[model samples]
Target: MTMDKQFHEILSDTRQDFSGWDFSYITRTGRMGSQLLSWSYGSMAIPLIRKAKSMLDMGTGGGEFLSLLSPFPKEAFATEGYLPNVPIARKRLEPLGVKVVQIEDDFNLPFQNRQFDLILNQHESYSPEEVRRIIADDGIFLTQQAGGLDCREINEMMGVPLNEEFAHWNLETAVMELEANGFEISTRKEEFPIQRFYDTASLIYYLQAIPWQIPDFDPEKYADPLYEIHQIIRENGYFDVSQHRFIIQSRPK
Candidate 1:
């Protein structure tokens, strides 16, 4: 097949449906891979979950990760701001006795004050004050954030705009914010792991799924840059970029 035809075919295949925040397609296809962190978020959260009488998982996308941390607390609840994922999360977690709530905004939590003993957030936007309001006096809040500069090399390569919202959202910044919100920081760490994409197709699929990375991304509109990136991948065997991530654990002051 001609290079143009091959590129189009790959792009077409990569643009498949990506629902419920599941990334099995990318992982199963071996199109993309990332290095592991020193500590696993699940492992870090298990102990906290075990100790708490009530727990809340913020932004539980399809309840995938929350479901994995099984044997939930007596009062297990989850909030999902994304409309489509709310039903999916309910379907997956409700059977397990998890209360899946649909949230209209991140700043406002639909719960009584001091309701949860443990709160977990993974790659979710949050309001520190809301977390403070909902958490019990001795409650713990643990979050793992996706750093703003994650995969910025892709934007540079494609000449797309970078997401600068969390550009300064490091461990220090997170700790400061938590402290400012009346939380005493316990643990914090940050890592920049290398992520590798074996083919341009995987990259295209990722950009599509994560539109914020390149807000106005379109395969047809970016065909020229995509072609150039494809050539680079063919020559180099893969494209590699750094993925910034940070984890913080805190409790009310």
Candidate 2:
């Protein structure tokens, strides 16, 4: 598929209906997803990150990476697509002297060419155009994404089988997209057997609201009972799930 078409599909898949969802419940007891993201980036990009003056952390959720990156960077700015996350991120990062910007209205970054030495995306939604257009010639782009096989079990639980074509998420595809955008591959790191515990109901609650899967699914037909089953898993001492994370580091060609 063309990059534009692929990007459209990605955007569609990640749209979540938060009309009645409870945010406080998740944040209070939710699993810290950043632990996985941090582990992936530390393993993939930290060693290659040399001295840099300015850096951008795309989709800097919770600003954990930005906080960690502050010591090594002279100036660090973060962009987040979701506005609800902005306040918390600002609160968490601003105290640490990091600048957090909201990108909800604009996906095309407002920076000039070669303005930054490093750009990082830890599980951010990125298209080839955004990557190609925004990255500075000498800047580095490091991305860590949830692997293709990661969402299968959850999808099965939801009973809405994700279309295979729409589910084409893997290391080879990620490498190809980066290379196609003129990024020379520097490192590809894979994490196998990533295990996490989730109360089945909580998992479904997130699965329903989060965009890890596709969009426009039938929730009433599937979401409720799935949560009930999740309760079973929770009572059984949580469900042990495995996922793979692919971290690719690329530099401008």
Candidate 3:
């Protein structure tokens, strides 16, 4: 650990008990914020859920987003791959008559063919072919994805390489994959919006929570950049990064 007391204190902060993909601790406190997109995934999904008779919510982290979609269909199911979140999702969604299933592989979902009339995903990886297999011919699949360049500046500033695995993940490639896998794209939109961190601690908390943001993020290894960012935040009142986001609504052809 670095010997700098203040930086060390920030590193040792225990406030970031991240769970269920919730960022409320920072967001609710106005410590972190991002510019709003033109379309709201929740707004778009609500209407689809209302019209569907059976629905599936993939990667329902802690059931946070799915729980908000009230009046769930009679045959509703949510799948979560993160182990710690499975029980949490079940506890939150089961009472709403949603079956929460723990899953391992995105390519191998545990569901029957043509099982869902609506499928919703937010920031979750999915196999386009598998999605096509499980969804009804008329079923709509809605997703809001974080593109490959999301917050790339942060990694640049930290002197780290971007995660190569998702380097080519963007709206164009995603649409191409889905179209080839039998989905007819109905609506697609991509946006790059400003994301601001009011404090250096919040930025650290965020990177720590979302490990994929900087796969090799280590306070000890990146202490110099950490101090530099902290100084910038102190002088400028905030740090800024761009958010890469896209939304797609599609159905099997």
Candidate 4:
């Protein structure tokens, strides 16, 4: 009923949902693997942050966004959808003075109305309208979304067919979505041609990570061909892949 009570309830739900998630890979200590989450924070949230009283990071993966937004807020907090991710996030965030909670439901936000002065979302699942509800009246919401062309180009190059669900990405559509939700766009940036280079084995690993390829490809069967592609890449310096993203700076209209 009360906002604090609701936040506690949401926290409980988060713990349960993320209880079984495998986070070992994400929390691993090393410089060997790429820090994709950190990359998101730097590229998406950093430039827009200004001095603010409080900040909120939605879908705060691995708590990297919290770390990036810390300087902007006197106090910062985060909410994640998965329960398992909460502890992992807290383990990394709490010491840094950021509080984290888990969200149980898909659409509802537990915080009291007008709780945050700034909200950051990178690779978030919320639609534009959903985001507007939880933000303070004058708060700014900064989000970076992977563009539709990014997926389309990847799928085309991978020789895989596209699915209907991945159809919601497009620069025009995204801008329209924000405007339709009564958000006035202040800034927009698109970064592209971001390449992830791979050796033969690494190339195979990369391809295997694609979610839509699941239940469709026999990765084991393509083992040799994957390597062959890598050998080609070796001479070529990198396998070409494009990252299309739109960073939106928005405020309620």
Best by TM-score: 3
TM-score attained by model 4: 0.73
Writing each residue's lDDT as its tens digit, candidate 1 over 1-253 gives: 2357788787676665777888778778898999999879999999998898999999998898789888888899999988989899999999998999999887888899999999999999999999999999989999999887888888888896677676777788878888999999888889999999889988888888888888888887888888888988999999898999999989998
* Model 1 worst lDDT run, 10 consecutive residues: 1-10
Tens-digit lDDT string for candidate 3 (1-253)? 2445776788777365778978988999999999999999999999999999999999999998888988898999999998999999989999999999999999999899999999999999999999999999989999999999999989989988888999899999999999999999989999999999998788988988999988877776777888888888878999999999999999999
- lDDT (Cα, tens digit) per residue for candidate 4, span 1-253: 1223432342233321223223333224220133133235465566545556778888886685466445555567888877657888888888877788898764677776678778887766666776777778898888777665563444555466666665567556777888898889887766664445444434343444444433264444544444445455657755555666767778888
Better of 1 and 4 by lDDT: 1
**True-structure lDDT of candidate 3:** 0.91
Per-prediction backbone clash count = 0, 2, 0, 3
Q: Give the best candidate by lDDT.
A: 3
CA RMSD of all predictions: 1.8, 9.6, 1.7, 12.3
TM-score of each: 0.95, 0.71, 0.96, 0.73
Q: Which stretches in model 1 have alpha-carbon errors above 4 Å?
A: 1-3
Worst 10 residues of 2 by lDDT: 1-10
Comparison by TM-score, 1 against 2, better one: 1
In the predicted model 1, the residue pairs found to clash are none
lDDT of 2 at 70: 47
